[model samples]
Target chain A: MKTVKEGEIRRREILDVARELFVTKGYDHTSVNDILKIVDIAKGTFYYYFASKEEVLEAIILDIVEEGARRAEIIVKDQSIPLLNRIMMAIMAQTPEFEGSEEIKEELHKVENAKLERLYLKAMLKRMTPVLQEPVLECIKEGIAHMEYPTECIETILLLGHMMFDCDTFEWKMEEYPQKIQAFLCHAERMLGTKEGELSGFLQMFGQMP
Target chain B: MKTVKEGEIRRREILDVARELFVTKGYDHTSVNDILKIVDIAKGTFYYYFASKEEVLEAIILDIVEEGARRAEIIVKDQSIPLLNRIMMAIMAQTPEFEGSEEIKEELHKVENAKLERLYLKAMLKRMTPVLQEPVLECIKEGIAHMEYPTECIETILLLGHMMFDCDTFEWKMEEYPQKIQAFLCHAERMLGTKEGELSGFLQMFGQMP
Candidate 1:
């Protein structure tokens, strides 16, 4: 039998290979056999790590969520940054970029992979809600922001933010995209108790307007 | 050869039967054959009316959306009601209740029917966005609310409101449901530029908090 460390390494290798294939060739196009071909692992070995392709997709999403949580935790704990900037940074950290992320995102937008898209968003919100709550509550306590139901508000904001701003969640027209981002910033400023135009700078982070 | 009127009537009949079966027996359990048996129509007749069960679902959703738009149009045109109340009424009109709506909602919440839930929400937003825009813009013009991107804000609010409040969109625990509604109200007041607690009275419309 393989040692525990060796088994762990094998699982990591399989996940990496699967993610690469999913991004490069698309999730629907990629298969367990393709993963096994790249990882040079037997079908039994692959099944030992993941029960099915869907499970592997879930595993990939979990890894992204954990990485985001870790980054957000660090940002929350840092005191040198301003409260608003730290909060924004922490929020952006939740969308950590990996190689070929854009291609993977394109794949997720297809109709056949919508369930996976939903799964990814749901998983991100579930995992990041708690991690981002710390900085948000701190902002409230510092009088930088005020909310009656801070915890619930945080969760609502995250859910709305994801649903509105995430391209995978909606099929926005090319011109409509920039307007949606702008509107999100405007509402976010109000929701966070920030002054008008305070959050406008973050629009650049969303990319250039058409 | 059937007359145009007869064809339209037969189409409506098929849709009505399909919707009933979908709600009562659950969408997954219902089939085209089941619908045909209830409607007492031949297979060819059913096909002539609806290409597939999924098309019938689209027709049902379209019917609901059109009904909502019609109601909202009337509410928006009613100057007798106060502006705020009219706006609220118009927004509420988008969720027009039909017989067995609660049951249909329950059916949509099932994991197997998530795609239907998403499709329904998307259809509602697409149709209701324009209908609701008139009242929202009126609020901005009357100085009752302020928004930088009024049209975009309305769409974002509707999209967020649906995703956050609609039980089909997320699986909130019993306790979490009320908190989310409360949070939404707080955020809505801020986003709408209403005074704090101004929108609190509308929470009753969401049903009693458990």
Candidate 2:
């Protein structure tokens, strides 16, 4: 039993070191040898933990999903905040941006990783959408009850928000990223039947706008 | 000179047959053998014209780009129509939906072909953007002059329109495709400073809406 626990710990350690290296050197540039060297583990031990570098990358993605779910759970349970705010928080929580390394985020945006990054995003969205859906609908219900949102096409607007803002499909310009976020938020707010500038503070709180 | 002209005709014939097979059978399912069977051409003659099946697909994509550019040129030159209408027409023209087979459109959307399709789209956008940029801007200028559209963020809205509508990134439901198009156009009209329902007739004309 102790050996099994130790093995699990060792596996996690390998993932931690590999993830850091992937963030700094990028997934393609960070070879298995580099991971072995950093973790000071033998080749056989590394192989025992992960079948290949791709497998390790996939494990890292799963770990992110798990972490995002945990964060979302906490935000969703916070009854102190308004339901709509909680929904926005819950959605933002699923994005890897909040606690993730900026360097890793930038590394994933490189041209060589575009295909892999899109795959990761699709997987993450698939995982995150279900976790967010019911909570968001509850929030939408509250918004409608409060006379703050339209009820005609609630589902479509939720999907639009998920695809357009919550996911990383749109490229953000470094200089104009805030402006873009503001514009998107304004549009989303309008679509949801929220008054203009209602969600502006959420954008500021999420660090997406000034 | 007569022989060269005949050879050119033969090359076009090969492409026509290959395109039809690719549309009906998909790029992966349509082997060079199938194209050969359809065209009844010698392997040597086929190889003399094209290097590989991928090369032929690339040629087809180039042909599409050429045709789209031709259509765009006509739409952009027609000053009889309103500027915003021309811009909308120019965008709708670039999409393969206007002329290509629905089977080919569906084939390009398959999971196995997602990467290849994205590459094709990126290539198409890169090639087509430059050709359409001047005319689009001129239309924007006309829109602004006519007070039908906003002036401050013309380029951004154009980019948004191209990315949101021209690309096949968003999946449309069979039943709700028309409704989604209407919502998108309404949002875009609002963003562009046009009055609501201003572009409804254009969507109806495109057969995207009843």
Candidate 3:
């Protein structure tokens, strides 16, 4: 058990170092050698943790998806929060972490690195969707139960919710974040046959994002 | 002038045959030599028209973008059609062509070719957006002139319209074509401050696609 714990800690340490390098230097510019040097790990030890740079990228994306799932799970289980608010919280959970990471912004926006960023984002969304689906569906069920949404078009509404929740992946501007969320919530209310202002509380909460 | 015309025709013939082969075989599987043989062109002739297979792919994407822009121009210029219908027509133009091409489906879905398809689609959208922007702006102007839309939110609404118009690139299902369009149009009407049922006629026409 001690050996297993040590191995896990070592793996996370490598990831932490790699993420720092990737954010500061950009993914393409940061070589495996750079990460190994930063972590001061032997070549074999580095290989033991991650097979290649692409695997490191996949690991980073997996970490993001896991975090999203974890947050979503917490929000869904919190019975005190309204269902719409819970759903909004689950979807909006990613933005704060992203906004907190100021170091990644310049690297992400570098013209030459845009494709790599898009590729990773696309991969992240594909992996994240399946993990978040359950919480999203539960929220939808609660919305239906509360008569806040119609029951007839569950599948379509679920699909639409997935797309709307993935607006970050859809490349919607962060500058227009409030308007986009408001517009999306208004449309979702229309689609689910709810009253116009039924989901306004969630929008009000989203507007307070720092 | 006659020599230029002949050169244009020859270039198009090469593109036509190459497109057929690309649709039938995968892009990676279809070599330049294969295209040359099929078109009965000398190696020098092939090189004269295109530097590489990548260039051919770029040319094909350019063709698609040009066609979209051309259709957008026609729809926007036609004063007889209602402005809402013109906007709907511009968005709908690409779907039928995409749906009708059964051969391209296999190539597009191939795992090895997915990256190439994505790269080309990204390039096509980049080129297509500016071209379509004019017609889209005109539609919004007409909407505002008729007091169907608010003038203050023109920029945001324009951005939203571009997103809505790129639904083909968004990969919304042809299976959910009618529902997607109706839901989209209804939401668009709300966003643009138009009366309910104003855009329903376009949805009726879209449902007749066969």
Candidate 4:
């Protein structure tokens, strides 16, 4: 392997330290001084990479969004995959925000401080929309062509599903059950008017077969 | 109509004043004195009915929960209605606790008062749970009976739907479009594994024409 660059290594170290400190001490509760002491980096160096604490947060969020967008696009493009399998793959691929414990807890605790919660929520919805939309839209096209579920309500279902996923705070416990997640996705595909047994096998493919 | 009792009228008037005030001044910022002032009652008179400000808040919540529970049960018992229809109707039936202009302004001025926000959130969720649960259980039942969708995930959907509705701060300009709401609900019901056209004619029933 080629030798790692000083800048890349240093920046990665900074993010790791910052993420831990932010997670443990909280964003508002943790200060620049604490980060400096923990990482042993000059404040100037920290400032060189990040203009403000908010900028660091912005970087972290961008990481989530960029990764989310990539995964969503990848699954959406895999047209040969069955709709339900693609849905399951998309879910596991995206992992959403809650899937990250350190990230989820820290963000929630710091929500009162960052003024970031609402924006974060909106970003989350936007992030997931394509992951859901691409497959559902394709499925709808097929369903309509074949005259499956009523065509009149297609857009309505899509928007509502989008809103619900955007806003709903399914208990954290539910995440513990992968079977449940798979089931729900199947339910969504079915509503889009996919034929039965067509997507049934997908239920077993998302995160540990139930 | 028969004359309303002085005590009953006075109590409801107090609850009305307290609910509005709690939303505005916040649970902590607005005290017993403020509620009494708004209701035009003396401190001792307020104490006569409610031992403390919390009690008055509790009374308001209890009223909401009781009414919500009653309505939710009624929806649960309707065999003629589709499962998705019941869930959407239940959501429509329960009043959403929107922060009024005054309340939003006050909270903005204070900024980042988490404890107060959490308390208000808890009280509101308590009022909302029954309104949210019936459809979840129904989805499970219907999914299993028809082998419709994964019966297991319905719980997560309900749990998430409640929290999202409670915590979501997005500007909802779309509620005015009842067709959109109907489409979303019908689709969501399908996502939970019910059949299409299950809620056909649902929009007209709500008095929204094609």
Quote the positional error of residue B183 for candidate 4 in Å.
2.3
Q: Report the CA-based lDDT of candidate 4 relative to the real structure.
A: 0.55
Candidate 3 Cα misplacement greater than 4 A, ranges: A1-8, A23-26, A33-51, A61-210, B1-10, B42-45, B74-81, B96-182, B200-210
Ranked candidates, highest DockQ first: 1, 4, 2, 3
Per-residue CA lDDT of model 3 for B5-107, tens digit only, reads 8899888988878777777785668899999998898999989989998678657656765676577667767879776666557555633154333545444
* DockQ comparison, 1 vs 2, better candidate: 1
**What DockQ results do all the predictions give, each relative to the true complex?**
0.52, 0.14, 0.13, 0.22
B97: Cα error in model 1, Å: 3.6
Most lDDT-accurate candidate: 1
Q: Write the per-residue lDDT of candidate 3 for residues A1-210, one digit (tens) a residue.
A: 359889998899888887777777767788899988988888899898888986776576557556765776677678797666665576566432544434454444344444434444444445445544554566566554222213213323333343334323234456766765666566555544455677767777666542
Best prediction by DockQ: 1
Off by over 4 Å in 4: A1-17, A23-29, A36-59, A78-84, A96-119, A140-179, A197-210, B1-17, B23-29, B32-63, B74-88, B97-179, B188-210
In the order shown, what is each candidate's alpha-carbon RMSD? 2.9, 7.2, 7.3, 8.3
Compared with the true structure, what per-residue lDDT tens digits does model 2 show for residues A1-210? 459889999999999998898777877698999999988989999999899997787687678767876787788888897766776777677666524465565544555455545555555645555665665567566664222223213333444444345433343456766665666565555555565577888767657532
The residue pairs found clashing in candidate 4 are: A167-B164, A169-B160, A170-B160, A187-B191, A188-B191
iRMSD for every model: 2.3, 5.9, 7.6, 6.2
lDDT of 1 by residue, A1-210 (tens): 789999999999998888888888878799899999999989998999889997887788778778877888799788998878777777776665655665566755555555666777777778877877777888888888877776766666677666666644456877777777777778777888876787788888777422
The stretch of ten residues in a row with the least summed lDDT in candidate 1 chain B is: B103-112
lDDT of 2 by residue, B68-132 (tens): 76787688778897777776787677666525565565555555455545555555555556655
- Give the winner by TM-score: 1
lDDT of 1 by residue, B1-210 (tens): 889999999899998888788778877688899998998989998887778887787688778778877898899899998776776667777764656765566655555455666777787778778876877788888888876776766676677666766543456787777767777778877887866887777788776432
Query: CA lDDT of A22 in candidate 4?
Result: 71
